[model samples]
Target: MTPDLIILADTIHTMDDPPLAGPEDSQHVQAVAISGGVIAAVGTRQDAGQWQEADTQVVDLGSATLTPGLVDGHIHPVFGLDLTIGADLSSASSLDEVLALLQAEGRHDDGWLRGWGLNPNAFGTVPLHRSVLDRVTGDQPAFIRLFDGHSALANSRALELAGIHGRLEFDQASEVVCDADGVPTGLLLEAAAMELVQRHIPQESFAQRKARLGELLRDFARSGLTGGHIMDHSEESADLFHALEAEGELPLRLRAAPWCMPGSDEESWKELARSIGTGGRRWSIEAIKLFVDGTVDNGTAWLYEPDVRGESTAPFWPRPEEYSAAVRYFASRGIPTATHAIGDAGVDHVLTALESLRHEVPADVLRRTVHRIEHIETVPDDLVARFQGSGVVASMQPTHCTHYSLADHTDNWSTRLGPERADRAWRCRDLRDAGVTLAIGSDWPIAPFEPLPIMADARLRRRSGKPDQHPIAPSQALTARQALEGYTSHAAKAAGLWDISGSITVGKRADFTAFELDPLTTSPDEFAASSVLGTFVDGQIQFMLERHA
Candidate 1:
């Protein structure tokens, strides 16, 4: 039989082993055959020739290392693109720079001026408030999101428009920062408070959302991503994705988890489960999302003890017992759940819920629908052991540790955790050694979407170059192979799509990320600086270096 395509590379990592554990490890392969968007064969160059025919369209990728397409375990595509339409404050180093950026944005004709990626570290010792933003925005109604997405700074005009008067009650500790006289300060913590101002901002029309998402997916392919586990989704997003799949070829695969809030009733949960539709061929909604707590920044994370600011530690659900009930409800039906749990207390609650549900869930179904705890920023050694055989996957982001935290344990996040818990930041090595499944991702918009730099950070425990950059718990660093697996096999397993994608095995989807250097042998410094030569999704070339020799 004539295969549709043949990809020839110098090396290929199948990710089917324990990552070069012994002298017998051999994951390198030379060629692969694709037929009907599935791998027909994978072996040495000579072995693959038996599956090829005269009409096979062979792609000679000279000296390139071909591996399974990278999978981002967690990301927010539509939301991230929506943020990009406004001023990008990610580069602003100081409060003055932030105001200058906002001032320039205010000059535009748009009714509401919006910006994203604001880092509070730029403020020095000064406290953030709406008054400062009002100086530049005036009556423009500016709302800027912090880099971590857990907090936002809104001008007084924007707050007035949203009608935020007093402190708001929420399942989590969302607060509308108040001054000495109990006046709103225009600083919103967590979604409950941020949404007050955010809801007033006009939403992107369905047409606009579809267009922007299409653009980002194409960019994702060029950056070597074949698929992503979208952390949050809506009915509109589901429809937009299916519409794109129906139109023609999609650049990448999408597996989205719809947002399931705490206050919704059981009937509502059942309705959401019923309304969930299957993706034509490239996308699907198979999981649900919940927030156990907010990020570690801004003192919103649910913790055993209060942060440096003495903020209350609370879960996102008004009644956490209800959260356990919800998990049980979904787990009984074989639906996987992904909870956003950053603090140890948050993770602890989720583990308890999973443990209670385990008794009722069948082992096979439980294994297939492994519930995940997202952004496990801090966990104790004892709690880490609970994940060993608990059928719970830890979905973590390496760049959160590298890009945001200082290795010296003096960064904002570290300072918030204090010395006692700061040392436990992103225990990737600890969890993996404890026999727990570790799935890594970029968390997109929160960090860069590229997998190479993320993998490098996982291995180095620090950013590339700059001798002054210290390693955060260097002992917790992952090996090059383990880091690669996080984005390949382990990620696919976390998403429950291991049967179809993830590795370069026969009978799997023909998705390949070709790089110029062998990732296994390359140093973290060099690998982080390398680029993708080409990307293939389901046997089709979505992106290739056109100018390359």
Candidate 2:
């Protein structure tokens, strides 16, 4: 009767009920027994005694809390790995700091230097041109991405290397901003910026990429994450994931969604679908990703109104027809689609396409296909109701609300859509009230992929700082329990793996996260800094924080 593993704790936050519910109702027992990598029982200490025998390993997590392992519902793991090699300007708060960092790093002559996580807003204004960058970087080509990843700044030499000497061409929806003299500025918004950067960084070798992926996987495990949904993948990425699985090195559970090119032929998509099927013990392909538009920082997020500077609605990639066709094709094949749509207009276009497809496709086809609109940042009131009834999932990142200065955005939002529409930004509470399923994630490489930080933001509705800014509709803030669910059980459901993981019940995978401080009793700031004492996936200890005897 001895259990292979027994975990006992002072508190267990099942996240099974509302936060106000007393501990007894929300959780039970001091111990959880696991056998064959699945929860065998959840009951009192006395009950656990029945499962205990000579060989049983008792793990007494005294004074700590045990909860379901955190699942980062959305992220770009490949991109996360790439950051290790790229210039790390994420912590540079000001333009001067960024240049100083680059100067100290000393860029190579032929190598393309790239840095991510620079927020222009953090410095009060966008760094205007390559002149400042040129002064610091000398002749080396440098590309620095804004924290949001929607926009990027490139030095003159980098632009020249890409053959975009003084000016760059872009689609109607994209922009390559120029100075008053009509010369190309360092900044390029959305698709255009990505195009230039992509042309410069040559593809990394498979061996190098595999090593990077391994490092990232370990990092995720230490953060108490057991699974993640990779939003953007390529053929190379998919193959790498499979190779890792074969080698038993794919640390966390993976749901890879590769980018579906705009205007892809039917045969091509079908072939890609066949190549990437579902359910390996460690990896699966549950969705196809499409980029409908870009982020707000670069002023490229397709908005209902013009940008604050009086620019027209931002561009859409792949065009409406091509995007619609791709969605319909994926729908017909019974595969869910995740579209990156940040602005109101972008969300509207995606919904319109899905709505149109729903009518043409059979009822069964539509029901089987669960469409997701990523980053529903600015939704319309009417669309909120439609989204609720349409079975669309809102895969959102709450941390974005805190990271982007809402005060600056509020002024621009009100000017664009009037105060009435401004209330609809990241409506987590509204969507849940309307009976819509919410899946939360950290768009990593944009923000750190830690669930607690996101949970705190969702519950508090404000960041740790000076108040007086308009919080995103306080009524829309989720309770602590609801916020946890968004990142756990609900996130699993979004990725189509709810039944297999996400909960702490008998017959479920024994994946759990142990925290140094009980979240139930900890302060918001303490929760944000809480450490993961241990993480287990499929009853195997993936990470354990070193403790001194």
Instruction: For each candidate, give its TM-score against the true structure.
Output: 0.96, 0.90
Per-residue lDDT of candidate 2, residues 404-469 (tens digit): 646444433334544555567688888888887788898897887877777777776766332554
Alpha-carbon lDDT of model 1: 0.83
Best by TM-score: 1
TM-score of 1: 0.96
Across 1-549, the per-residue lDDT of candidate 1 in tens digits comes to 469999988777777644443421334478888999999887778876787788899998978898899989998897676556577887887888988888777644558888888877777677888888878876788888888987899889998999888777765557898998888988898777888888888777777778888888988888889889988877677688777877777798888888778677799789767645465577788788888888777877888998888853877786888888878888887888999999999999999999987688777777667699999998888889889888799999999999888877767788888888889989999988887778889888988888888999999999875447889989899988889889898988898777887887779989989998878899988988888888998899999987534
The per-model lDDT (C-alpha) reads 0.83, 0.75
| Residue 394 alpha-carbon offset, candidate 1, angstroms | 0.7
Which numbered prediction scores highest in lDDT against the true structure? 1
Candidate 2 ranges beyond 4 A from true positions: 17-24, 83-85, 122-127, 166-173, 180-182, 191-193, 202-205, 278-280, 408-423, 464-473
